[model samples]
Target chain A: MSATATIYLLTAAAVFGIGVYGLLQARQILRQLLAINLMGGATFLLLITLGGGADGPPDPVPQAMVLTGIVIAVSATAFALALLVKLQDATGSSDLDPPDAE
Target chain B: MIALAMDAIIAIGLVWLALRTVRGANVFSAIIMFIVFGLIMSLAWARLHAPDLALAEAAIGAGITGALLLVTWRRLQVLEGSVPQVGAETRSLWLTLPTGLAAALLIAGLGWVALSLPAEPATAGELAWQRLPEMGVSNPVTGVLLGFRAYDTLLEMGVLLAAWLGAQVVASEHRPGALPGPAHEEVPLVGALLSLVVPISLLVAVYLLQAGGSAPGGAFQGGAVLAAGGVLLCLTGRLEAADQASLIERVVLILGLAVFSGVGLVMLPLGEPMLAMPGVWAIYLIETALLLSIALTLVLLFAAAPGLRRRL
Candidate 1:
């Protein structure tokens, strides 16, 4: 059981690292959005793993919080996507850099 | 042994999907990969002993978020094609890899220590368990969200509302009546598909809400499910986006907040805590209202329009 938790945590950490690397390299706004979401998922995983219990059932508090975080993530993402669409329409470029760069 | 293997497989798959999401050759594939990553994360939540989290992740994280991403991807396609540039800028190994490695090390150390710690001698979780019966909810997670910590839940709803408002503020003055790419009419068999999916999703949303009082479901989960149904309608052209928010849309958007604030105000004279649920009945009543308002808000947000109308 303890070992299972460790594997989960490590997996989450690796995902977080990959998301961060992607965020760094992402030249497109859409890819960066996906990376940010991946990072959020990793953080949720980290919270749940950290709140694990060895014997009794897992903590309900963290579970509830993570649940809230998931919904909030989607809401934020939806708004962000809307912003992306509006931005693309305004500038004709999905990349956020200045128009002069083109 | 089997458990370990299952864990290993799922974990590796999740990381792989995350990597692919970042590295996918095109924006469309990257969005697809991100959706898969969300689904895998949902399964991981279940394995971590969090069915509530799993349900929310699958419904909201993977399902609704996927819809939003795909919609954005389609919108992006309209832009005149720009040649892809692979690496305009590169960071030194000293700059990038080390921060990632350090984050991993810190997380690993924290997990090991967390596992080794004997136990919380007296934790809020223990207290929550002991008080669960008093909350009159079978699901401890639900109880915490809507009963004991109702304040936080209320504020979360506010955050969602605020996000919608912020989006509206940033919206262009001449909001596009309908998105440019093929109006919903051009899709093949979309009507029949939506007729089936929309109702079923709504039913599931209601069930999730009702069951939430006693199980691994709640307003947020139910609302997301409902939003999914709306997404299907929008995709199929059964529902059209509107420039001006309808009167009814505005009412439903504020229903949850209104009901919540009303309850708190009504109870204030009695000298109870603001927003303190008077009893189990009040809890259910508020949850129902919250569920409805949340569902409507999510659907409205997804439509990216003020109102929706049945297809002509």
Candidate 2:
């Protein structure tokens, strides 16, 4: 692989790891959502890197897939936020855990 | 050499921003960092030679998502009567360490496999390129989306519609309406800005739709640009959510899926395969419908309403 691709692949790996950590460690549902999105971004980068390789025009198949994925991600995010708003309205807290748990 | 250096910097920035977005001092900061992450990732897409993706990432990933996040944060503040501090409560490290380590190992393994794959292996991408002429679209991505993988594109529209419906279901009894924004009637520039920006965005969206036949633009990108205009109007209080959708709004909302599946299924009695568009005309028809539907769907999602109306 080209050095550029290698560098990006490694970056993707690291970002994925960070996302995983965030998802595990976050207390707030919104924070977890952000982490999930981070993980999704990492996967997109990795997929495109794999498709593009070192030279020639980048592949369109993966590009189209990523485009679709981006739209889907936003849709899911918006729905999740809507759910989050309702959760906050009902429970008066953004955290997933109930107050009595502590 | 300089290009390599730029890539390295972007890679580092992405990793850093991802970390910060997760571990920032507060929820507000984390959200901001996430937006910044989206912006930088778009730059990375450009560097990776995917201009279509770059445009999508900047507009949808960063712009719309960031706006949604900020709005949610504001809502949380309103509910609690104060800005909630994220990351204030600490979790036990014992549970975190093993999970984090396992995830890191999993990613490392995936990366190793990705790197170990042979270079230039024949892929569906190559096949799509070979068959591009039959699709009648010069843009390979557009060809794959509308022609070769039309099923995926079709389902994606369903997903968008489903999401909007889901949002409407989950929306609280707040009577979704225009978000309280700076209604600066005193600023003469606001009117000038709207007059210029809205029309320009419309022009750009049309140009993108037309260009998709031969270039990097397409229905999704054009739709996003158009939605940005709607979002601008919402922010400036030119638009507001209504309790019920107007008849025109309801029809336009379903136009994409309706036109797409209508044309696709109509080919069945003629003995053509499902979703096999007849010609360039059919492709443009579906795409135009898709552009309108996508723009409306996204704007409604951002607005979090069953319907929208002009603010008088």
TM-score of chain A of each: 0.90, 0.95
- Runs in model 2 deviating more than 4 A are B82-107, B176-178, B181-186
The candidates' DockQ values read 0.54, 0.69
Q: Report how far off residue A49 is in candidate 2 (Å).
A: 1.1
* Candidate 2 lDDT, B1-312, residue by residue in tens: 999999999999998999899889888999999999999999999988888888889988998899889888877776777644443454777976787779779778877877787776647899999999998989988998898888889999999999889888877776432366554664778789999999998999999999988987889989999999998888888888788788988998999999999989988999999999899999999999999999999989888777889877
Q: Per-prediction TM-score, please?
A: 0.89, 0.94
Could you say which candidate leads in TM-score?
Answer: 2
Kept native contacts, as fractions per model, are 0.61, 0.78
Q: Which one wins on DockQ?
A: 2
Which residue runs of candidate 1 sit more than 4 Å off their true CA positions? A53-55, A96-102, B79-122, B180-189
Interface RMSD of each: 3.2, 2.2
> By summed lDDT, which 10 consecutive residues of candidate 1 chain B come out lowest?
B83-92
Return the clash pairs for model 1, or none.
none
